[model samples]
Target: MALISDNDPIYELLDKWHEDDEYEKILEKVDEIPMEERSNKLWFRKISALNNLKRYDEAREEIAKLSPRCTETADIGRLFYMMGYIYDQKNCEFKAIECYRRRAEIDPSWDECDEWVNDSLGYAKKDMDRAYNAFSRFFPDYAEKNQNAAEKKTVEEPDILPYISAMGSSFMSSNLGVKLPLDQPFFKCSEEDKPKVVSFLTDRMHITDLKSLQQDFGRNRLAPLTSNILHIIETGEEPPLDKLNAQQLTHYEASKLLLGKMKEFIPEGGLAAWDYSDMLAIARFMYSVDMLTNTEIMQTYLFANDECKRLFKSWEEFTHSLTIGAFYNAFTRDTSYNINQSAKFAINVGLFCMQTYPGIEWLGEIKE
Candidate 1:
C-alpha cells in the first residue's frame, strides 16, 4: 500500500469534528499534534469552530493571529464573513456592517451579508422605538424633541440569541449524568432568571438520580481523549497512533470494534432520505438511548455532508427552513443529553417546517 500522508488524518478528523459540531475537540486535537503539522486550513477551521461554539472572544483573538498568515482569497473571504457574523452576534451594528461590506467587496454574490444588513437596520428601528416609548412616558416632550434625532441616531439591539442558545456547559453537565429537565425553558428564560429557574427545576426534575447514574458515567474524566479516538473511527481515518497514550490506544481499539456496526445505520443518500421517516426515527431513537456511540454519530455526519448541503444550501436556509425529522436527527445525534438544546433547536427548525408543512408535528412530545 502507498504511504498515507500525515495531513490526511488531520483534515479527515477536522472535517469529522466540524460535521458533528464538536468544536472544542477540534482545537484540542489539533493542539496535541506538533506545530509544524499545522496549516492555514486548520487555523480557519479552528476559528469557525470557536464562532459556532459562541467563543467570540477567543475567535476574535484567533482572527488576529490568522489575518497575517492567510494568503488565499477564498480563505480571506470566509474570514471576513465569519468576522461579520461574530460582530452581528456581539451586537456591534456598524462594525458588523463594515465587515459584511468588506466581505461583499470580495464576494458580491454573498447574499447573507445583505440579509444581515437589513436585519441590523430593522433592529436599529426597533431600539429607537423602544427607547423613545420609555423616555417619552417620563418626559412628554421628549418624543417630539428627539423624533428627528432618534432617526439620525444609531440603535443597538442586545444579543438575544447568545443568552437564549443552549450553552456547552449545560451539555457537559448532562453528559456527566445530571439528568436535565427537558420541559424547562432554561435557554429561553432571561439571563437573570436562569439561576432561579435551574434551582426550581433541580428538585422538580429529579436530578438526585445522578448519584446512581454517576457510577456508570465515571465523570467521563477521560472523555476529552476518548472523544478524539471516537472521531477517528467515525471519520474512517487513522491518525498517527505513535503519538497517542495507552488510554487513547484502548479507546481507539474499542472504536474500531464498533465501526462496522456504525456503518449499518448510515444510509447511502444520508440527509436526502427525507421521505425515509422510518430511518430518521431509528436514528433519533438510537441517539436518545445512547445506542449510537460517538463514532457512529460521526458516521452519520460523514454520510450527510453532500446531502445536507443539497437539502439546506445556506445557513439561512437551514435555520429558517429545515425539516422536522432532519432537526431531530441533528439535535439528538450528539447533545451530551442536553434536552433543552434539543428542544430549542427543534423550535427553530419548526419555524420553517410550519411554513412548508402547515401545523405539522413530527415529534409527538415536543411541539413547535
Candidate 2:
C-alpha cells in the first residue's frame, strides 16, 4: 500500500485483469514494465496471477525475485503473506506456518494472519500426534514413558535438547536417528592428524576462536550502521554518499535494502538465537576435531541451550528466529548473496527436523 498510488493507470489495468480472470493478461502487463520500474503492486499482481494460473513454481520464483526489492514494511509483510498462501496451496504446511508467523510478527493488526498460523499449526500438530500415536501403538508405554523423561531431561541438560533443531539443514540430510556426522573422512583422522582436522573444521564453520566467538556475542558492532540505515528508511533523510568509501557505500546501500525485511521477520530474541545456534554448530565441529573434549562440548551446549530456552518458547519459534538471523548473516557478509534461496533452505531444514523427530519434546510442546 505504501508503494502504490490510486492515480496509477497500471493498477487500473491490473484491476480489470483481476475482474475478467485474465491472469495471463495480468502477467503480460506486469512483464511490460522494466524490472527497476516495477512497483510492489506490480510484483503482487504478477504473483497473484501466477498463483491463479496454478503455476506455483513460477509464482515462487517471482516471490524470490521480489523479496530483496521490498523497502516498505507493508510490502514486506504482504510478501510473506503471499508466500504463505503459495506454500499452503502446495501442501507444505510447516513452511506455510512459518511464513504466516512472519507476517503476523510484522503486522500484528492483521488478525487473519494469526488465524492462518494457528490453523496450519493445528493441522501440523494433528499430523505429528497421529504419527506419534501410531508409533506408540507398537510400543504401548513408549510415549508416556519418554514424555516424562524428556521433561526431566529438559530441566537437567536443556542445551542438548534445544540444540537438536539448531542442527538445521545438516541434521535433516543425515539418517534420522544417527548422530550428525562431522566431515566424514576428517572425523576418523589419527591423533597426529587432529590439528589438521581442527583447522579444517574451524575454517568450514568460519570459527576463528571458540572462546572469542562466545564472548563477542555481547558486542553491538552493527548497531551504528543499522541505526543509520533505519533512519534513512524511516525519515527520507539520506546520508551523504560521497563521504563513504566504495566498500562502506556498498554496505550502507545493502543494509538499507535489507533492513525493512529484517525488521519485519526477525522475532524477539532472534539475534540471540542466531548467535547461540552458531556457537552450538561450531561446538559440534570442535568436538569432532578434538578441539573440545566431551565435558567442554557439553558445557558449551548447556550454556547456549539455557539461553535459547529463556529466549524462545518452542522449536518452531526458535527455528524461525534462526532463519531470520541466517538471512541477515548472509546478506550482511556478502551483498550479492541470494537470500531467497537461503530462506527456503533454512525453512526446509526446520520442517524436516520437526517431521522426522516428533519425539523431541520441543517439537511437540507449544509453550506460552
Best by lDDT: 2
Worst 10 residues of 1 by lDDT: 155-164
lDDT of 1 by residue, 1-368 (tens): 33235467677878888899888899898677665656767777778888889999899999898788667777787788788778667654434555666676677677787787677545534433443333224222322333433233221112111111112223334433342232331223344544544443344432222242233223322223334544666686887877754334433443333223222322322223322222222222233344455555334433333333444433222222223223333322433212234334534443423232232112111112
Q: Which candidate should be chosen as best, given TM-score against the real structure?
A: 2
Reference-based TM-score, model 1: 0.35
The lDDT per prediction is 0.45, 0.58
- What is the TM-score of each predicted model, taking all chains together? 0.35, 0.43
- RMSD of candidates 1 onward, in order: 25.6, 14.1
Q: Can you write out model 2's per-residue Cα lDDT over 226-337, one digit (the tens) per residue?
A: 5556667879898788776434554555455555545644445545555665556555556655666667766776666666677676554565566555545554553233
**What's the lDDT for residue 11 in model 1?**
79
**Candidate 1, residue 309: CA error in Å?**
64
